[model samples]
Target: MAGTLHFHPNNLFAPCITNLFWFKLHHHVMVQFKKYVESFPVKPLFIVFTVLFFITPSAIASVQISRTQILMGDVPVTLVVKTAKKHTIKVTRAMEETFLLGKKLSDSLSEFSSASDISRINRSPSHVWISLKEPLSLFLLEKSVKASNLTEGAFDITFSSSNKHTSWADLAIDKHHQRVMKKAAGLKLGVSGIAKGLIVELMSHHLTKKGFDRNLVNAGGDVYASGTWIVGIRNPFSPEQKPLTKIKVKNKSVSTSGLYQRGSHIIDPHTHQALGKKEAPLWASVTTIGNEGPMTDALTTGFFLLPFHKIESIVQQNTGFKVILITLKKQVIKISH
Candidate 1:
């Protein structure tokens, strides 16, 4: 517990330790406080403990929701949000709304799933336009297009679930009607690279608009914090042990795309396959921190597909983004803000 909140002042334990456990302890403390109430010299520490334990400014609520099913791969989806208990209803409602939005976005982007916007487009006949209709779908498509362009097709979304024929160059958007068209008849899209971050963004925005401060939204491993939050980076080699590093972030999105979380080379869009020990050594795991979830999410995947030397231009152009690369040899590469 030395490295825990006992030393860190983030009020982490206040939310994690349940009131039921503290209440039982509170009863014993009250007994001791009463015994020392009349005799101040007897146990002054008991009164202090009782006050700190029971009379907190307010309760903090941390909730984790299990999504009905797994997402892209066999990776199960979980949504977590933390906030002050006083606004429990608001936070819960915000989470509910966010999850619904996530489902819609997932169905639209998942190439593995059929009957979605992407699947329908792929299933469509050649040169036929499929209507995106929904504004959110159009927005996500736009972001994916931009990500592909920004990464020079490294972060392409045109990866089909069942075929390898489609690519970034085959996509086209009609802004006048808010629709997207695929030049290749069987083109499919997968936005899992950036969708996780968008979910975090939406959840954070909804929570913030609901008047909650000190809130955090973590969808699986993608995270965004509106206030000071201590986030842990997963250990690539060891999953059962503690996190490799803990960083405090505020008003930022923290995204880690690697084989550690997905049990495969999730960051590699080109191969759509896991990397071997001798393959892509430096990009074994990539962690990027930024203000936007989409940007952080996009960079983690796009940069992982490129060589370390090739990533210099991206970081040099972006002012606030920071990246940490853990090589296959266990060497650490840090790019400062």
Candidate 2:
């Protein structure tokens, strides 16, 4: 019978043929090795069996595991780690510890929690110094304060207060003393916008300390990638939820603040209100990549509120920062420094 042959690399039949060829080659080699061993005074047959039984599978197989859950009450957190099968238990244990660490940090920073340090700051009387006991809380607050300055008040933690005159400027932060005081009464501050990124960054650091060579920590739209990872940006207008683009990042954080992710949820600190269609920028989504997750997260939110020219200026000022702007009309613009 005449038969047609298919040998395309992408086809299933090609793999079968390749496996058969390798099997025959291996069999022939083994037969020759046996004959040679018979001629030798002593044979090392156990060495060959050990290589086939122990090392072959280990060399061919690797393991990847992931965990996804809603962290910090509402934010979605995902952890992905890759390693050899032999270290599966170690990686899993590291992931569990990382999750616990994230939860503890979230609880400490949560403004809704009466026991939280932030909530205590909100409840404190004006002009009274409150010593921050937790090191993590102090660090986060210091970072938030710095972010306000970096973004020119566009990334203020106190942006949500009903009092328009009260802002981050009204708060006195003493990082050296580990204390803070609100100069204006009812000047409530919340780090919900930037806290997720901070948590993810710390989680990534913990995983690295645990000896995970390849890992990723994603909290909502904020992400930190260790080693190399390809992350996808979602198409906001796609009904089928396709990726708008993909970017490879190594030891960096990529954050996206978009209308698609939250739908007019970003409040303009300047106006003390949600960004209306008219008030919003021409870009529907603003993504920023940087070495620090919190900064990238803050930049994305700040860029979304600022004009395009202003955003370009900020991107230029920051070294090693990259911005991707997706316009309302679906045009993509990139700015890198």
User: Each candidate's lDDT (Cα)?
Assistant: 0.68, 0.82
Clashing pairs in 1: none
Q: What is the per-residue lDDT of model 1 for residues 1-337, given as tens digits with 9 covering 90 to 100?
A: 2222221133224322234565456556656755667687645686677567766655544543323335445444454555555756766676576656666666656655676676666677656667874566677777787777767877877654455666777777887876667676656666777877876677677757766655676666678888887888877887678877778888999988666775354534466555454354456678889888887888787877777776777787768888888777767788864
lDDT of 2 by residue, 1-337 (tens): 3334544343222322235566466557666866876786545676566456766786757788898878899787999998878888989899999999999888888899899889999888899999987887787877787777867888888987757899888989888989999999879988887878888999999999999969999887899999999988878677257779889999999998777675487877888777775575556788899898777887788778777888888878879789988899988888987
Tell me the lDDT of model 1 at 279: 54
Lowest lDDT sum, 10 consecutive residues, model 1, at 1-10
Per-candidate Cα RMSD to the true structure, in Å, reads: 11.3, 8.3
Q: How well does model 1 score by local distance difference test?
A: 0.68
Candidate 1, residue 132: lDDT: 72
Give model 2's TM-score versus the native structure.
Answer: 0.83
